[model samples]
Target: MLPYWRLSGFYFCYFALLGGVAPFLSLYFHHLGFSAARIGELVAIPMLMRCFAPVLWGWLGDRSGQRLLIVRLGALLTALTFTGILWRQDYLWLALIMALHSFFWHAVLPQFETITFGHLGEQSARYSRIRLWGSVGFIVTVVVLGLLLDRFSPAIYPQAMLSIMLAIFCCSLLVPPAPVAATRSALPGDGFLRQLWRPGVLVFFFSAGLMQLSHGPYYTFLTLHLEALGYDRVLIGAMWALGVVAEIILFMVMSVILARFSLKQLLIGSFILAALRWLLLGFWADSLVLLALAQVMHAATFGCFHVVAVHFVQRSFAERYQGQGQALYATLSGCGGALGALYSGYSWNALGAGWTFALASVAATLAALLLLRWMPGRAS
Candidate 1:
């Protein structure tokens, strides 16, 4: 049996840190007097590193069969490195800190995903149940910290984030390593490269990359956008938490969703919803009703999308190559997210929020089209 709670505990703490970063980090940079472009650059640094860092770490984890060890190391290094933010306030210094901190931080999750799946074995469909704890963690942090930020200064953000980082390090220690499958006596004739180059696989990755690309604006500046629209920090945080709360509900029912729907159906639906969500945020920022409706789509956009993605990756690769498979997904997501952040920064500054998110909508629409073209007939 899996050490369910231990694994879930790690996710809870890990995403609690994410909750701290995603919604508030830009606000922190803004409070420090950085412009939107600079904030985007700083945020993109970690994501840019994620593009390559995970593959390297995934390689080592697969070869060494020490994924949990890598997870601990990543957690410790990320926590240690992020503390450098306390030492400097300049853009260059912050960028450097982000680079160093992210290099290791990005390495942790993909490998941990591999470990979690390995633990689940044939019961892989239960992943969302284990994963929902992370959403709960996110909701807790985003809401509580949002309320706190309203009362206190945004200066408290760093200390609060550092505390969550410490918790992640502690969680990393609680879970044991996953058991390895015995190697096949004979290797496949097609090999890893051949499998990766397959048409459906390539399309899946390209489509997935576009999906993350569409999230650039949402993740980087949604809080600031809300603030600009006259919303308070508490309300902004509640809005962010609302999205995750919706995600939690989806995660709870994801097993049933998966059992009924094909991965193709879920992926297409997620992209379509993501496109609509971005459009709503772009044009309807002032409408609390529409904003709430858009937030609720997180159930489809992230929750359903991600659950299907995890399953797709697991089914795509051979047992021994699971680390690499997850790593590839992480790398592609990082690439999309990095580009999204970088461009969204420039677009938010030059073109404004509406156009920035409109661009995001376009990207997601393109992804859905790609999925439609390649993933037909429920083969997935």
Candidate 2:
């Protein structure tokens, strides 16, 4: 229980940083007078780096049995690199800094998960109880930052974000190193690449990637879109926090939910909800009621889907390759998300919000179909 609380504290800090970035960063870039396409590029740059960085770092953590060291290093680098935003607001320089920051930031979580599961031992089903702290942190940051941004200048956004990153770095330093689980053992001579290509594994990765990709537009443009529709920062922040709050509730009950439903069912349900959620955002942007309802579905779209996917990865891979499995999941999701964000950015300018989100709906529907056809088994 102590370890759970400690890990939860780390999650709380880590995702609080994400909560700062996800809902507000696009608006910050928008305030800087960047065009929609340019803002998309700026936002996507970090995710692009995230696509590959986790694999390298995860491999090192697995090989050297130094998961906590990599997590701390990643957090420290993320804090330092993000400070570059204070010095350079030029699109190119900001993009480079964001990329470097994300490269390290992305590596931290998969290895952290490996550590977390090791600590959980046979109580893995209780992961959500701990993970819910992250959602709580996200909500706290989004709501507080939203209020702060509403009261203060948008120019202060990066400073506020930097403060959170600093705290996260400090928290990382406090985490006790997680010893390797007793299950760590060498794989067959066939290697990770071969294991990665197994039918269900490939399908799962691609499906999860597409699912995350579908979020690109929502994450990259939703704040700006709401602002364009005359919503204030506070309202925008509430909307963002609302989703995470719902996600928190879902995480709190995830073990029971998983017991009743298979991972495939949850994944498919999440994609279906995602498609509807985007369509609602696109067509009903002006309705607070509709927006609120759409936010609630994030429980399904992100929370349930994520837990099920993580469990699936844990069950699918050997203990020795656990970090690699998590890393691969992060890599595919990051790459797909980057592409989706970049594409949505270009389309936001050309097609407008309704059409751009409509496209995301389509992508999510496709992801749902793929999951239904390819991976029908329970996540066990």
Candidate 3:
């Protein structure tokens, strides 16, 4: 058996923390009275660390064949490091803390992704089903916390986040190490580097990075933007939840969707939808109905795009290097996200929301063009 619950439980708690951060972290930083640029820098710290942390941990996991141990240690360290937020409120103090905790926290997901796919074995298409639990966690946490923050205060954010981190540590203990069964391709260690150098593979990574880069404004500022537009925190939370609800619905039928479509097709569709989605947010955000419709495009922008990306990484590398493959994906995406957050912060203040999102739309449009031209049309 696949220990489905164990895998799902870990994702749930892991993304519950994400749910807390994505919508509320900026609000928390705002409450701390930091400038927009400072908040941007603070948010970018973790992503900047992700540019290097995952590969280091992935190398260790692959070499030792001890993925579960690395996961536990990473989780525990992440929780411990985050508690430093309560220790001091200075920018330098939080900066150091963000970099430290993110180094470990970023290490967890890529390895866990490798392990989950290992568990799924021949049923790799089922990945979306397991991943949906994370979306579920995001929805529940965003909604509940949205309500709470509205009723109580944003100061409670840290305490709620701490509890979720502990839950993640506990879940890490429940998932046993994945069996090292034979992979579809048995490439030698040197072959992975060679495969990574392929032109098609390089283009795919670049496109994926662009996709995440386009999300910089959305992830970092959507909540604040909505609030500024006169939406209540509760409605903002519901809007966030609505996107995940769309993501969940997509995951439930992803196996069917992928069965009938190529990864190239899905990636192209995702990028195009992302372009339109950002444009909607930029030009029509004042309309609640239009905003809600735009949120539904999360099904393609994130949910489908990610499903295709994971499978692409799996196909491009041999089983022995799966950890490294996933790590590289996360690392590249992180770099893009860091740049996006930094630039968006500066732009959000200098250019305003309208122009910032227009910039994001351009990024997504460029990614779509890359996918259309470079991604192989054949199923892998």
Question: What is the Cα-based lDDT of residue 77 in candidate 2?
Answer: 86
How close to the true structure is residue 14 of candidate 3, measured as C-alpha lDDT?
98
Stretches > 4 Å off in candidate 1: 30-37, 147-156, 181-186, 227-233, 349-352
Question: Model 1 residue 317 lDDT?
Answer: 72
Model 2 residue 209 CA deviation in Å: 1.3
Residue 354 shift from truth in candidate 2, angstroms: 3.6
lDDT of 1 by residue, 90-144 (tens): 9999999999998999889988998898888878889999999999998788778
Error of 3 at 165 (Å): 1.1
Which sequence of candidate numbers ranks them by lDDT, best first? 3, 1, 2
In lDDT terms, how accurate is model 1?
Answer: 0.86
| Model 2 stretches astray by more than 4 angstroms | 27-38, 87-92, 150-152, 179-187, 224-234, 284-288, 349-352
lDDT of 3 at 236: 80
lDDT per model, in order? Answer: 0.86, 0.84, 0.87
Q: Judged by lDDT, which candidate is best?
A: 3
The TM-score of candidate 3 is 0.93
Which structure is stronger by TM-score: 2 or 3?
Answer: 3
| Model 2 vs truth, CA RMSD | 2.6
